[model samples]
Target: MSIFHGLSAFPLTPADAAGRVDTGALSRLVQRLVEARVGSVGLLGSTGTYAYLSRTERRRAVEAAAECTGGRTPLVVGVGALRTDAAQLLARDAEAAGADGLLLAPVSYTPLTEDEVFAHVAAVAGATGLPLCLYNNPATTHFTMTDALVARLAALPRVAAVKNPAPPSDEAARHAALRALVPADFAIGYSGDWRAGAALLAGGQAWYSVIGGLLPEPSLALTHAALAGETAQVAALEARFAPLWALFQEWSSLRVTHAAARILGLCDTALPLPIQPLPPSLHPRIEAALDALA
Candidate 1:
């Protein structure tokens, strides 16, 4: 199976207030994902603060996570950066650090044209032998990758999967449309945690999840149930996630997951600066939300 396939759990790159990675905390997070038997481990993704960290720090994050996974789990490291050369170098670093695959997003301050994104993705895909997943996170990347663009990029060598933003409804139509554009085996995954169950039921090949980053067991149960076409089982698990999912919509998944990780005692690190922590008043709600999943 492709590293990007199935339940690829992404973990927050635990870092102190100083923007320095706490590898010890990081290894523990990856260890939990490995022990849960998730299909793969996504390192340095948006949840992992890939946009905030420097190359050296990102490399350190991968080196540490690669060690924790230790070939037991496939490590798909996010190599998204502002510059094509920098992203290419990051891809190289991840491969050298033992990553099994790469996740590239069109990250630019000025909006990127399709031609620009195409060239950028092509360069990074060529940088290493590892397969790459196109990260279509318009909410963060500010560049929305269209289906035509996806089809164009899919033809590039080693571009094997796409982490798309799942639509809330009509997931089957959405999934079928994208499936028609890509290869039969090209992995078409979804990221929005609240919408993942429906996506899976509609044939989404993977769940590039945020909540699964901190809380994997329940997420895995949902993933397995949906993938197996167990409607009642998936609905039950999806209800358990309702409270937390609402929090995610309001506070954003990155901030909520940062809070969720701390609440669960998995990691106590702060998100990189300029992104403030969830106000203390939100703790009770977050607590109650987590309780639902419990």
Candidate 2:
């Protein structure tokens, strides 16, 4: 069975003020997440700011994470790039760096046909020996993986799981239908802090989480409750995370989460250019919100 089963923490890339990836800081961050005992660690994910970094930086980030984890935990590296060849190359690199699995999204410049999407994933799957997770994040990628395509990819060798962002409306039913459509063994994980509980409650088996990266213990508590079908406990955990989720709602989670990490003294709060840093005014609110998690 694949170890890609539970809460996979998506950590932020700790970069220096000049936007250079701080490998030492990143190593420590991965160690912290590993020590927190999250089910898996996702490096160079969306939260890791994969798109912002150069190829060499991304490679170093993956290597650092794998080196730090050192087989203690599953390291799922994101190999998402706009071009198929680049994605394939990253997949190969992640596999070589000892990553446990690959997470790929259909990132594109123009509108992509379903065939193009399928081909892109297929090429990456062929490139790596590691298991692959199809990241269906339409909001960011602007390319949606329809059910037909998902079923087809599920049949591909090395394609093991999917990270789906739960829809805002009819979440339970939507996830339930998705679950029924895919193969029985194919894992359908959910992200989107607001919809995680609903996705888990609706039979989704995994959560590719951003908040969980910073707060692993609490995130695991919520995941464990969902798996045991403990509805009340799940609700309670969601309520606990509401403050952080609310901050995510107001500003982007990328901003608030990095700010929260800074507040907790996790790392330097320097995000890459083009993506602005969290405003100073929201620091107190973010600090207070993070305090609530404690």
Candidate 3:
């Protein structure tokens, strides 16, 4: 699906203190991305606190986002779970809820081997007709998907794309290495907001963006400039994003993004417990960062 090939904005899934998804808020957030004209709405991804939510709440989120998108934009719902059966059920749930595609991470409690992960991903891809994107988030998942492993998974039915961490250096070389391994049409994208612009300029087909969810126009600007190979414009736009990028690296994009959302009047819901909101002391810095973007 083309859903995996552009700016896939991952929005925060707002919920009440009781962990019940605030469907109204969730719908509003999804609609924002659609109005921004993003490639897709990436609902229930890590930024959405999918791991912290119960399956029921996740299903509710997909339902709300699907209703809001209403085919106006593509919806790529994250169906990552610790158990194979649960992931399969989530995939089925997303399809039933009107999602256009699925993003599956190698979510695990035990350290999984390459063979184990291959089987896990294959199972989920086989479970649904929707195109599946492999989520290679080693920092959170604790499983690094080697290039060879990605090549193996690409051949599986319904495996359409991948969202890897943005390269820290040599974006072209890194992107080229992976491109050589996968099929010509396989969509290759990156996350890690700070480094993503370079990845895009280096021929990354997509950006699985956290900031794009909160600040779409500028993100789209950067995406457009980079896609068009406008190096000078890309550098200028990326500079304004520098301060926020620094904060994202220091405080984590999850906390910083939730803070930005509140500041922008997007949502007032807190990050699900154990993952507290950013400290009050950091609010000034966040303000200054948002000011920089403005």
Question: Root-mean-square deviation of each candidate, in angstroms?
Answer: 0.9, 1.2, 1.0
Give each model a TM-score: 0.98, 0.97, 0.98
1-294 per-residue lDDT for model 1 (tens digits): 778778989999988888899999999999999999898998998999899988999999999999989999999999999999999999999999999999999998998899999999999999999999999999889999999999999999999999999897889998899899999878999999999999999998899999887888999999999889999999999999999999999999999988888888988888899988898889999999999988
The stretch of ten residues in a row with the least summed lDDT in candidate 1 is 1-10
lDDT of 2 by residue, 14-117 (tens): 98666678888788888988998888997888888888877777888888899888988999999999999899988888888889999999998899999999
Badly placed stretches (over 4 Å) of model 3 are none
Candidate 2 lDDT (Cα, whole model)? 0.86
Q: Candidate 1 local accuracy as lDDT?
A: 0.92
Tell me the spans in candidate 1 whose CA falls farther than 4 Å from its real position: none
- In model 3, pairs of residues that clash are none
Go through the candidates in order and give the clash count of each.
0, 0, 0
Per-residue C-alpha lDDT of model 3 across residues 1-294, encoded as one tens digit per residue? 477877889999999887989898888888888899998888989999999889899988998998889988999999999999999999999999899999999997899999999999999999989999999999999999998999999999889899999989999998999899999889999999999989999999899999998888898888888888899999999999999999999999999999989888889898889889998888889999999888
lDDT for 280 (candidate 3): 81
